[model samples]
Target chain A: MSVKLAGELQSGNVIIVENNPVVVLKAQYNKSGRNSAVVKVRMKNLMTERISEAIYKADEKLEGVMLERKDCTYSYYAAPMQVFVDSEFNPYEIHEETLADITKYLIPDMTDVCEVTFYEGRPISVLLPKTIIREVEYTEPVVRGDTSGKITKTAVLKHTKHELQVSGFVEIGDKIEIDTETGDFKKRIA
Target chain B: MRRWDLFCRVVDNYGDIGICWRLARQLADHDGEGEIHVRLWVDDLESFAKLCPAIAPRSPVQAVGSVEVCHWSTNFPSVDPADVVIEAFACELPLTYIAAMARRPTPPVWINLEYLSAEDWVEDCHLLPSPHPTSPLKKYFFFPGFTSRTGGLLRERDLMSTRVAFDAAAEAVFWQSIGIPPRGNEDLRVSLFCYENSAVPEFLQSCVEGPTPIRVLTAPGAATEQVSRWLGRGLVTGELVRVGALAVHAIPFLSQDDYDWLLWSCDVNFVRGEDSFVRAQWAQRPFVWQIYPQDKDAHFVKLGAFLSRFLHGVSEPTVISDCWQAWNGRGRISFAWPNYVANLAEIRRYGEVWACQLDHAEDLANNLIRFVREQV
Candidate 1:
């Protein structure tokens, strides 16, 4: 179904804009007159993995792309493809290329109970939890008196190898909750 | 000089065609023309013909001056896309036409012209590209805004100079042509053009009982209908009705240019929608806007944004703001009119300075042409 009024488009709405599947990152509505109403949206192309902005009339209809979401658990990697299975153990294979940049966060054993999206019978992408707990892979010893995490120091995540910023008090063996969306360090647990 | 295909769908009334027609004429009337071709495809010719009298409502293709207006139907035939394809107001082009565009050795420069806005975000979204998934083609979003970063408002080459040279003698002749008797300086000569507003009856009542006599020139639409509903009779062209100090003379539907003249001659213009609102600005007259009501009180925000920006530096913003609020059903217009009418001198001067400020921004057609030039 078409999304009525571009103003109704919300974050996470998958729409076909310019024939490409895109997820709306943000939707902002601004009208300056009765007949002059518009909605400006920032969208990320699911295929090309590029961020772009577009404007639409407030009442303009947008074609939406429907995708099925399933709760799944990461099992193992089958070379260029990462394997996942549901609670019922129905196995699914998704291409490493399809996962795009998110593949770096796919810790096969630790990142469990993830959401996989199916489009036209193929797993196109994975939705990461807002926050995830990952063990620190490497970081220099905490700098003395640099206790405040407000200003972060660089640390790498175990298995994923994704670099994260954490407090100077954190050590290489510490486990920290990291926000997946912004990739910001949330809290540490020794 | 290149072929330009402009597509417009009349979503409401004349606004869509009015804008498309103006842009088409401006593009075709390029300086030192290298023989360019412009084709305007409109889905509704009846509404388009209302704005452009030269159009034949039933004709599939009608040549009006330098531009060819085509009646766009559902069964749109596949044709070669122009060097520049403008989908006005994001009216999606025909699927076949889009397919044809992608097949070209070099695809046409596609533009999705957005609605005009005074919002801050318009600047960031202007000229951003929407790359097509299936085809190796990209369409740019064009935002019409009050700022130079935007595509700017639609204006013609001679619009300002012609408005500047408008003669008082000619204005008097115009009043005579419209069956309006010579006016007294004390009488408030007003042009009433708005959507169906419930506040109008109260406004009429205010004009009737007010101390100063008022002469109203109204077209045959919402405002006129409201007046007629109050009078309990349909108002005909040239028919005059007087109740207390308020006297209204019904006028025939004026063409776009004549409408601008009407704004120019009137003491105040009550304009609605996009086209007339913009014209009211260029006319350099104190005007009140009755924005079209939206689904969820959205129009109020738009009204506020415009009012805040437009009246920011005016001498007495409160007087104008109070009247605008009253006009849009925020308060009783009767109470607001006394103070609003008192500040006419400031408003008129403010209008001139404001128009001068806006005149510096790039006009829509010129900006569009410049943007297209870089792409091709």
Candidate 2:
């Protein structure tokens, strides 16, 4: 167990609350008017897969549940669980509920190495690669004089059907790099 | 009676204790169904005494009205946790007290009552729960705000009606009570309560050179000192120093109730921090706020958020926003003052409209009661 301030805690970090190990899916820190700050987090329980949102003082000390993580590749998806295989072909089944966020970016046979976190050797969550390149399945035609990237329009990803904002210059079938954590367009692939 | 412990640590100004005391008194007065016996635990009683004369600084425990006030010492007393616990402004609760709370059969409804902000994020974060890491306890984050989604501003039950009933005769009495002569209609009366800022001299200079005769009442301590520095002379309580059209009077530090009266009596109010700022709004007067400055100019964002809400539907919002920015060290008060003063009538009328609009929000104390009832 390791101690971390609530403000320092980030996504993919597992924290112990009420004897349960919960992985943070997202964290947002906001400074109050004076002398204090607050951190709001969305987390999911490793054992029960119970998703919950909580707020904590930025300076609040929290116990982090250290978990073993292994680099793995997405192999397949069983009915209620997504399966990942390590280099040695060791299969780990993570609940589909736990993949609620990363599922949009998950693709079988993807070359990126995803990190699989385990508690007591039970696979809990998968951390996607920091940035992912995906082809824009569909978007409007490029608008004139929009090369400055000030304007943005929604574009749908090819395989995942995930729609995200892209620069106005981006057109259908254009590949863009997206920040996996925020799901924001990083840059357009030439 | 359902008991509550409101813990407040006075960091620098009286804003912390002022707000806590107001909430405690309001909660004590408006115990809707069951009695909510509020105990305000303050670290600095000397400061608390300034706001409420009834508070005995040396006493360990004393009752002021229905609320019980306790001196929160470094050596904390071993007391049972209340049914509901509020740590005001994120002041950490004593570890021993938290331990006692954890021992309770059904853990107390713990709340970290945050500072007031008009920012959009406040609504999303308000009333959210924070589960304790090791203990079987949860604390909720309650934020006071201008909107209905967030816990509203602090307002006493009779505050509005009381202000409305304070007629010109009552105003004359208030002036006499404060050692000031009756205010003439020609003199634009303004109350100044703020932290030290670079804009003070410029503001004072503007009043001195402006066409309108302005009478500035500087609240004791920092505000008075600032005015004195600008005057190149020390100020004594009740001493009026005249410079051109600007006449500055240094008033003694007043009780919380009297301070509210000061805001109500003023044509324009300059308020700082949390408590006085809220009171200025309830006063329904054209006011300039100097938000408690933070590192990296973060407070400007908060000020902008409030200005956006306050300036809604107003013609020429910059007239107010510019003066506010200048007062906050962003622009020149000399340039903004003319625009601000020229529109005082419009601003004053809008102040009434703004206060009435804010009235629609649930009062902070009542909001806490409804939230607590739902939880415990």
Candidate 3:
């Protein structure tokens, strides 16, 4: 169902645009000294694959979009697309183009549910978990008292039969959080 | 070519006005024959006058090179419409100017030149466009970045040549003329200028304890207060004190040109905030960056990204990394200082190479000319 916003939404706010819920990418707060504030929000249109930035008065209120989440199991990769089976055993396929950046984190039958974006009753995008536990392929041997500043090294990720190369310093067999959003290693989880 | 107007509100700092002045001068100088006429509207004409003595603050309008420097007032002037307009660092253009641009035949190339960043997404987001709802204006996002895909850093032609001809003896005489003493042989000459940072004490102690003497040239501001507190005595012009092996020299306030020379002359520069940081990079010397701290320590990520790219090929990467982290953390300065100094030669070479690479990027003025030509 199409949802209309009550007022203006700030940038970075996840909202319903048309029938699809999208995130506000940027918000410019324009107000002179002692003047009323106005917010100009730049939004990414999830369903149509376009971006539109609009301005609104600061006092304007925006309607929050309702997003639905469900438990799903990873089925298999079809070249660039990733397929997932929900609780009803219904298969939802996401194009490889959309999931290509975060595809390395998807492990089959792992039971981790994914967040799917729906617009106008059609899936538009997906949001991955902030951190994914992955095995470290390689890390330099840690030296004691050698906290020689800002160390960054590459590591590989091994998930069952799937092997992926990631960069960060962590020992082999160590599980670290890989932030799919930025493609940077967060930290060692366990 | 699109006619562009760059509005700079200099907030009393020479660096801010200095940068904007360079951008304006270069834009006008190079784009004279092109379709661009860059009208530089600055609030602080007095500060702008300090950089280029040719600027007559009394004159409401005066020409310096190709740039038309106007004494900016609250009331915007009515002028012919331009093809492009820029608001530096999100500074608000006069409402009248915006209204006029909205009334233009063809919408101007509106841009908000954002501060420099090293974050990963900046590459993708740089040069993105945003449309004005009420007006037909479409403002493009221009982010100054370390990477090539982004709008490059501001570096003027003859900057290197000017830096290269910096004579040490002449600099000493110039300082002496200003009543500052000659540099001590053993002192590690440093230029101190930054925002308030918690790590200042530890960093100071490390400099004090280091084998070589540290001669610090203090800028007026929080750094001046810091130097005063560290010495437990008020600083006067040309005052020198021996703390351990370090001989801290507090010099008088310098003009913008002298500041550039100081960066070129110093063994290491401790520069904080955006303007000095860019100047330090252009100096081609081994320097430590004290990033402006933010909530949630977001500056750490920016600092990390820059260090990772900056020290990518250095020998003994770990030592360099640790030193940078220690300085940034404002912890254990004693440990980091020695390692940093030992690799000074190599780091200097690396910095020079990096500066050379950055020089390859189009100067902001030249880029503006090219941008204006293509659009017009």
Candidate 4:
């Protein structure tokens, strides 16, 4: 186990809590006024499969449980489970429920590799690449003179049907780069 | 009855001890729930003594009123853990004391009492639990705030009543006690308390040159230091320095309750840091705040968040905003002074409305008790 500051905690990092390993699904850092910084996390217990939310002082120390991970491509889903094939064509299955919010971004046979995390030799969580390019399936007509990206409108992604906010300059069939971790629109891809 | 151990480490100024002492006093003096026993452990008793004169600075262990005070040291003694433990302002708890808490049959409810903020995120973070890295203990973060969704600001039970009861005779007596002469009806009574800022001299010069006479009651320490530097002499307690229409009176350090009286009597208050800032709001008087500066100008964002909520309904909020920003070293005081002074009567009436709105929320001490009870 390696020591990690709570402020540095990112999605897919597993840490020990109450003698149980929990994978962080989301982490948010906020600092206001003269108050000490804090990190709020949404995590699920690996052993108990229980979801819980917690907050910690930004500088708080925690024991990070190192997990084995492999770069893999998303394969076809099999009902309750999602399948992935590693570089050596090794197949691994993780529960669709465990994927949480990431399920909205998953597309089969994608070129970009996703990370599959293993805890005690058992597949647990999947972490997507930092950025993913997806085409807009539907959105309102682009507004003129909005090059600054200050104006935003919701757009539906082509394959996943996932809806997210995009710059007002984007329209149907426009490819956009999105930050996978935050699911926020990054930039318009030519 | 539940017992609570409150640990406070004075980082620099008296703000830390001032807040901890107020919370500790209120927790101990609570009338209901079988009377909780509170023990406040402070590292700087000298600073604590300034707020409560009864505290013996050198004593390793002592009692002030119903609450016990301990001089926290490197060689912390072994003692049984209380039912609840409060780490004020995110101060780390002694490892040994934490171990004692873990060893207890039922571990204490650990809480990290965070600093006050008006930002929206405070509500989202308030009352969230943080599990210990190795131990089984969990500590919750409690934030003091102006809104109901967050843990509310600190206010003693009889504070409002006491302010209401303080009449003109009482105000005169308080002025006599502080060794200040009577002021003219036209004179604006201002209480100044703040940290080091380049804006201080300019603000003082503006006050001196202004047409209206302003009686500036400067609190000892930072406020007095600023006045002394401006006068090019050492200014002591009870010393009065006059220039133009401004009369600066250096007052000695006042106890906590007396400080409340000072805020109540003043026409305008210039307060710094957490304790006095919250007290000035409770005083229901027009006031200006000088927030403790933070790295990379982050404090400006905090100041804006508070001002947005504070000046929500005002027609020309910039009157207060510009003056406050200038006082905090953003713009020119001379430019903001005219508009700010013109809106004084409106702001004074607005202060009463704002205080009434704040009073609707549950106070910090009671909210803490409720949150702890629900958790434990």
The numbered model that scores best in DockQ is 2
In angstroms, how far off is B356's CA in candidate 1?
Answer: 0.3
Over A18-95, each residue of candidate 2 has an lDDT whose tens digit, in order, gives 788898888898888774678999998877878989998898899988789999999887878889999999999987
lDDT of 3 by residue, B189-307 (tens): 77788667666777788777777777777777677778778788887667777788666667666666677778888888988756688889999998888776665566777778888
Compared with the true structure, the alpha-carbon lDDT of candidate 2 equals 0.90
Alpha-carbon shift of residue B220 in model 1 (angstroms): 1.1
lDDT string for model 2 (B18-65, tens) is: 999999999999947988889999999999998899889999999999
Ranking by DockQ: 2, 4, 1, 3
Task: State TM-scores per candidate.
Answer: 0.77, 0.96, 0.69, 0.95
DockQ for each model: 0.29, 0.75, 0.08, 0.63
Best by lDDT: 2
Order the candidates by TM-score, highest first: 2, 4, 1, 3
Error of 3 at B45 (Å): 3.9
* lDDT head-to-head 1 vs 4, winner: 4
| Candidate 2 CAPRI level | medium
